[model samples]
Target: MTSLTASESATLERAADAPMLAQVEQWAAVNSGTGNLAGLRTVAGLLADAFAALPGEVRLVAPDSVENVDAAGHVKTIQRGDHLHLRVRPEAPVQLLLTGHMDTVFAADHPFQSLRWLEDGVLNGPGTADMKAGISVILAALGALEASPFAARVGYDVMINSDEETGSHASAALIAELAQGKTAALTYEPALPDGTLAGARPGSGNFSILIHGRSAHAGRNPEEGRNALIAAADLALRLNALKSAELKVNPAKIDGGGPNNVVPDQAILRVNMRPSTPDAMAAAETALRDAVAAVSHEHDVHCHLHGNFNRPPKPLDPAATRLFELVRDCGAALGLPPIGWNATGGVCDGNNIAACGIPVVDTMGPRGGAIHSSDEFLIVDSLAERAQLSALTMMRIAERGTV
Candidate 1:
């Protein structure tokens, strides 16, 4: 483990706890759900202002156009809020990428707003842990890094996207672009309450299959009409049956059923899949396509499949393992608890970065739990602790000239 210099230790010690919690409270109060474009724009403006304090050029880049298939089998374009991009010291010897998201799972109408103290050190609110606190940690760490003597040796790009909660469809291109040419990356996704991190992650995909059939009166000419709903149900069962040790399949929802008097002409099946390896991911995709084709042929219905596995599996390769070791050493040097990591079924922006062949420690954020629910909470003390950890990790990397 690399030891911290006097100047570096003093800089890390200055990570203020009160200011971090205050920033979390302020940012959590706003509802910036993925679908809430207005709220996301407001939050983006606020984050841009906050990150601007660092020495960088900040810009709000418009999100790319994304398409979604509705229940009626119609494709519609989705509008996502602008994302914030900041670049500092691009010409430095070491280039790093820092990423976070401004969006949460709670919609604008959700009642999970406002902060409350669940205990002396636990603060509960929406986006407080899932990553508003993580963002604050990133800001604090970067602020400290900028104040250090080795600041000029490290160049970094900050990407706080607006569509991460909904699969990062709009900001995916930008993510790939920013990840290019960076030596390493840090994504401020909250750690578990016990400070355990997510190591390798499975590849995930969401598919919406729209089936079209002929509609007829149920009592009159039912035999002449094809039922799309039945086909969709059969497909759902088939997908569920595909689950095994290597792949996880979930038939989440079905849409497009009509009154009991008539045979439904259109139906949609929404499914999610997580494959543990690249080969497993390929097999899953092929199995889904083949199943859909068979169902369509057997039921004599036209089927359209939308969406693909955008996040590929993130294996614990040598580079990623080395980066995790660096984080572990840095955490220990800061007097924090031992950092442990395990494979997770969850996928995040870090998966994309890893796909670019760049090593990333995704969960370098504050300790928190119950993310994506109304009970989401953040551990108050983890704010400064994680900031010091990240700051020290970055400083070490900058000093060594590699991850």
Candidate 2:
């Protein structure tokens, strides 16, 4: 394998510290929450401009757009008629895919849409660490590659899905299509605070359980009432009890109840589950069915559950292990720690891409903490470093021609 020489290494260090911060600052200012259609278009415009500047042909895949949620509760594309694809030198055998999402956990009306700086180098903002910064990294890395001598060895496709924050319902097909013949994929999810990547991720699914029962007045005929809320409570306990080493089930929210004078007739429970493997997922589903069946039988109320797996688990394969090695070497050359990874129960767009048989490193973005909360922040230094690492890794893979 070829390595970056002394001069190349110096160039990489400078590239990592490039003026990419300004670009990130600008992009972070835009709130591209998945449910925000205008925001999606706004970010899409920026991406279009960037891709247009590159020596490639860019096309919009989604012809029309709508709003929807994926199983993961990330803001997701409800209906997708189009998507954007940037293609350069497609005839090249060493084609790579670089994917990311523009949506964040924040909503259009979310107060957290504003950006701020924390102590030292942490910059807090909605979607900053989750990924707006990662987009900037891609641009910067591409900029560097455009100037590098080995640019000719690489051909790439960049896709920024509008609905990744959600389960990527709209973009799932597009991601699969793009990965069909690619050598590898690089996803720009935020790295861990310590700069570790994700080696494997458990499959995730979202479920909504609804309960129905006849209502009756508490004072007039309490015994005549069949309480749906009671049945829901029973189901929730049963679901929660299913948690173990292989599966985690959470009945997260409950909605619907009436005045004390009447027995509640309807209830809704929202649950989320993550399983380490496909078999674990099946077990969880069976357990859920059993719980609902038992509750319905005892309470004489109707129960319904909706939703299933959005993205399957991304297990590390030989191809992924090879990609990880390349990334580790790049990190070491950049004076960072050895590239390391751990399995996570969390799901991302990488899961979607991997489901298509494309080996990928999902958390290749910035390093930060407290994502999806008020305390979320981005490690400013990670902006340049991760971007440079990604650019170098892509160039290296292109030269190696995908094992």
Candidate 3:
């Protein structure tokens, strides 16, 4: 085992003493799913109160307005809960961004709401690893950092948003705003169960294409009516065909359809696209517009598209590689395994942070797996392990000026 310095040992001890498991249980018990506004509110308040323990100003920023395209092809406004932002030592020489999300994929009405021991050292529940436990990790690591002498050398901003599970639509601007002018960033998205990190994530775009056409009784005027459902089906197929090595496509659903007796007049196609690079992302959007245009002209229907690429592909640029090297060095100093990373399909606020041109090692949380399912679990012993890793990493960055 690598020997730790006196300060490192003491700081890690403080981080280890955080009530992470207890906090996870408390938060996982609350169903703060993206669509559950009330639940998001409750959890955001709880997080604000907890993070307030740090030396900083804690504020709950309201989510920006989000629009949804209905089955009837109408765009309507949707509500989301506030996001928690905490600022500490803002004027310090070394500034950092630390981020996580309060939202989970499990909804308030979801049945996978109870926490249970899956084994001696494993606990299963919603948001246990993705990422209430991650939030706990952030709190613990910062608490330790604040106690150490190195605290004076570093400044940080913590953002726990309410809508990450849904592509961070309501909080995208906030992520970009906080990411600006940071020395480095650490996002507490859980690591792989074996402790490997995610690197070079692909960008994601979600869109709802509303199609409208003339309606008529199927038997009486089938030829006279322009079927919106058929046009939507054509659009879905066209969108799917746009898939390639750089871009992956999924036409997930069509929101509108009526009686078999009539030619349906309105349908909203929900599709998602993932592009591995910025060029791919741009080309994908252009191909999409072309497909939509072809479908509209061929089927004689009106199509309205709504959405943008919420998360841009995060490439391992030179700056990002340097940050990863720093984190790996910190892990080595702790006598942990040689930390390494690989590209993942999953996207998070890390993508947004990376887009701001700051170096970031996003998967700094504990070893956990089966996220977004009833089987989600966080390794009990990993709480202290990861917090220590985070605390030391930040301390080292503070000791120096950059990653």
The alpha-carbon lDDT assigned to residue 92 of candidate 2 equals: 76
Worst 10 residues of 2 by lDDT: 66-75
Q: Return the TM-score for each candidate structure.
A: 0.98, 0.89, 0.97
Query: Model 1, range 1-403, lDDT digits (tens) per residue?
Result: 6467798788798665427888888888999999998899888888988988899899999999999998677899999999999999999999999999999999999988889999999999999998999999989999998888879999999999999988999999999999999989999999999999999999899999999999999999998889999999999999999999989999999998889999999999999999998999999999999999999999999999999998988998999999999999888887788999999989999998998999999999899998988889999889999999988889889999998
TM-score of 1: 0.98
How many residue-pair clashes does candidate 2 contain?
13
Query: Could you tell me which residue pairs clash in candidate 3?
Result: none
Query: Ten consecutive residues with minimal summed lDDT in candidate 3?
Result: 1-10
Per-residue alpha-carbon lDDT of candidate 2 for residues 125-185, written as tens digits (9 for 90 to 100): 8888888888878777777777776678777888887778778777887788788888998
- lDDT per residue (tens digit) for residues 1-403 in model 3: 2567899999999999999999999998998989998898889889988998999899999899998877667788989989999999889999999999999998878899899999998999999999999999999999999999999999999999988988888899998999889999999999999899999999999999988888898998888888998999999999999889999999999988799988988888999999999999999999999999999999999998898898999999999998888788888888888899999998999999999999998899888999988999999899999999999989988987888
True lDDT of residue 325, candidate 1: 94
